[model samples]
Target: MLDLRDHFFVPDAPAVELRAFTHGLMPKTVPAMMERFVEDWRERGVDAWNEVPNHWRPGSGEVVGWWTLPETLGDAFIAPLLGAPAGTCIMQPNVHWTVQCLLSAPEPFTAGRNEIVFSEGAFPSVQHSVYQWAAMQGLRPRPLPLGADGFVHVDAVLDAISDRTAWVFLSHVGFTTGEKLPDAALHAVAEKAHRHDALFCIDGYHATGSVAVDVEALGADVYVGGLLKEACGSTGNSYLYVRDGLTLTPRLSGWFADADPFGFQKQPQPHPDVRRRFLAGTTAIASLYHAVEGLRLLLDAGLENVRTDSLAKTALAIEQAEAAGLTLQSPREAERRGAMVILAVKDAAALCEWLKTQGVFTDSRQNRVLRLAPFVWNTTADIERTFAVLEDGLKTNAHQHVVAPASAGPVT
Candidate 1:
């Protein structure tokens, strides 16, 4: 197994650490770190640590301000996304949660003739769920094709918009190709959508911590992310950001978002003007607790530093792969890329198997691309070792291919 000690808090070798699964181990300093955050929250006069009414209870355990869940944890994580903007509403949950919330709104939040435009390559569940929901409501779901290089054509996306388009949604990074869309260009698309009275929503799951982000600077009306990939935490729980003063009645109406969830009224009163309006039901306390600690670690490390380190590592990986004669799949220009380095090859499945045997971990795409992701925890030596194994694998495969040309068949 790769030496993930620097990335993980585990001091022992990953292979020998059998006390718990990798996910079960909490950061050693999480308790101290969380206590500091609680103090910070109290200093802000929010009183997040205090025990409120029973209806306000999110879950048990040492509460990190009114149940950690996606909402509270998202607010802490939003500092990185929003560049620490004050008074911004951060909604942390999955894309499905966001969709559910959007679909549940009453009178003022009605779907009506509203349309949502999305790139086909975005998360399947989110794209399909929103599409099906819109269809049932007599609204149109527009699918735009991404280019062969994995970039959605901004011109084509702009052309698809019409007077009835209510929202334009897309992923900041293409999961298949590991290609990052130009933020400025996407923001321009958002501007066009806004001109037609459409809200711009971006799935930042692949973009968030892997790349530096500022939702306010990007001007996206809504952004979603999870800690699993970038922030290095457990999955399922994630976050959403809704710009200040932007009100939409949530479709998935639950106890959390209600104006006074405890009020015994048959109908819910007007929703709160704050970010809580987008929250539904109780927060995922444990995940939120850990996620908050994870975010603090990232923030303390500084996003600028993280971006610089990732770019340097990715550049080195690309250089090494090219030297080994692998076709580069991701864009060469650093500014146009994310943290992942993708290399195109003929025998992707065979190469992946060979790499695995050599203890070099990587992911393979459906086409012919091998993705190498070197997170903040990865070091220069790790990249070097990975390329050495890749070089050996390629050379071995090449020798076999040349020996049995007829049996080798055509390159994939």
Candidate 2:
């Protein structure tokens, strides 16, 4: 009985977008909020920044008492949904920038144990960013294997850590395969990483708004996420959540990190605390305004509701894909998979292109797996239509993509 498709900026109906796992569809309210943002820039000008009853910038990422205003409202609402406490989550321009800040912070990594460990299945953007950082720092990049399971178990991942390990960072869900790093795995890894003196960080882009997150429950030291993919926000808006006590002096300093940012004193000392230390130069505030409504919409819908729907959609998708004689690369069990379903088929790129022609939007990765993700806006009808086309396409057998072998793993 629950449906939210009317609230979103849906594509012309029958145009099924099973692609929220890749990027989000916008909410209808965002345009109005963004228009107000532009109007503020035009009328109040630079006063807009100060106009928002400013929330105190504690050195750590936690927020304090309630405040009303546009700029801080997003974080106030968004932090809890993403598993971070208020004031503790600082919005950055994007995930790459946040990761850059994390790598630049020199506190966590020790002299001999400065290596970064993540699985090969990590989103390439994150893996490459860390790779570049490790190269520049002369630190080793320890990329472990995903193996035949198409997922790395928690104990195996923890076993990979050594005294020389500085950071253990990976996605909450495997981007290509849609395998989730569940709470048990997350907690176990966090505890072990702490015992080994390594900071446990999560690249939560795939998990944040799409699923339930409790940062404290997960015990992550640092967590980074973006609104672009799952929160129906414009690009250039993301966040980094730092735990309360750990001090990581960010070498990626800019005007925002200054003790007296607006004072023009040009202080050399970045905030010694985790909060402001990582905030670099001025951000595109308009992008953040657009993101707020999406978070608000999700919160209104209830995270647990979304989680329940996500599982239902995923289970249905897997069932449908199987019924279509498609081999699923994702786990059949709802508990093991994320919000998306990945199916192994040859000529995936061509198949995705063909599907686009039919108004069914999807994404392909690893040159074999086709990703179809259903979100709050999607209905059982949308999914039925999408697969019906797939069935129709296969029957035509014209320019069809053959199904690939089950043994094929993700190329990433």
Per-residue lDDT for 1-412 in model 2, tens only? 2478888888988799888876688888777766766776787676666563222332456432211232254357657676666667776777777777888878877767888888888877678878899889888888888867777656668888888889998889887778888888889989888888999989888886778888889999988877776677767777778887878887887776777665778456776545667666675666666765677677778888888888888887888888999999887776677888899987777687778778989888766878988888888998888889987776786436543335566521
lDDT against the true structure, each candidate: 0.63, 0.76
Error of 1 at 338 (Å): 1.0
Q: How much is the lDDT of residue 246 in candidate 1?
A: 73
Model 1, C-alpha of 149: deviation from truth (Å):
3.6
Q: Write the per-residue lDDT of candidate 1 for residues 1-412, one digit (tens) a residue.
A: 1223453564332212211111223455566545645554556444553432221122343344454334544545665555635445454556677755654443222335367788887887568777777767766778888876566777888888777787778888776656677878778887897777777888777776657787877878777766666565555556677777777776566676677777857886656654566666665443454564444556667777777877887888888888888888777887778777778887676676566555565656663767777766666777788887778767667423422224455422
Q: Number of clashing residue pairs in every model?
A: 11, 10
> In model 2, which range of ten residues has the least summed lDDT?
62-71
Give the poorly placed runs of model 2, Cα more than 4 Å off.
52-74, 400-412
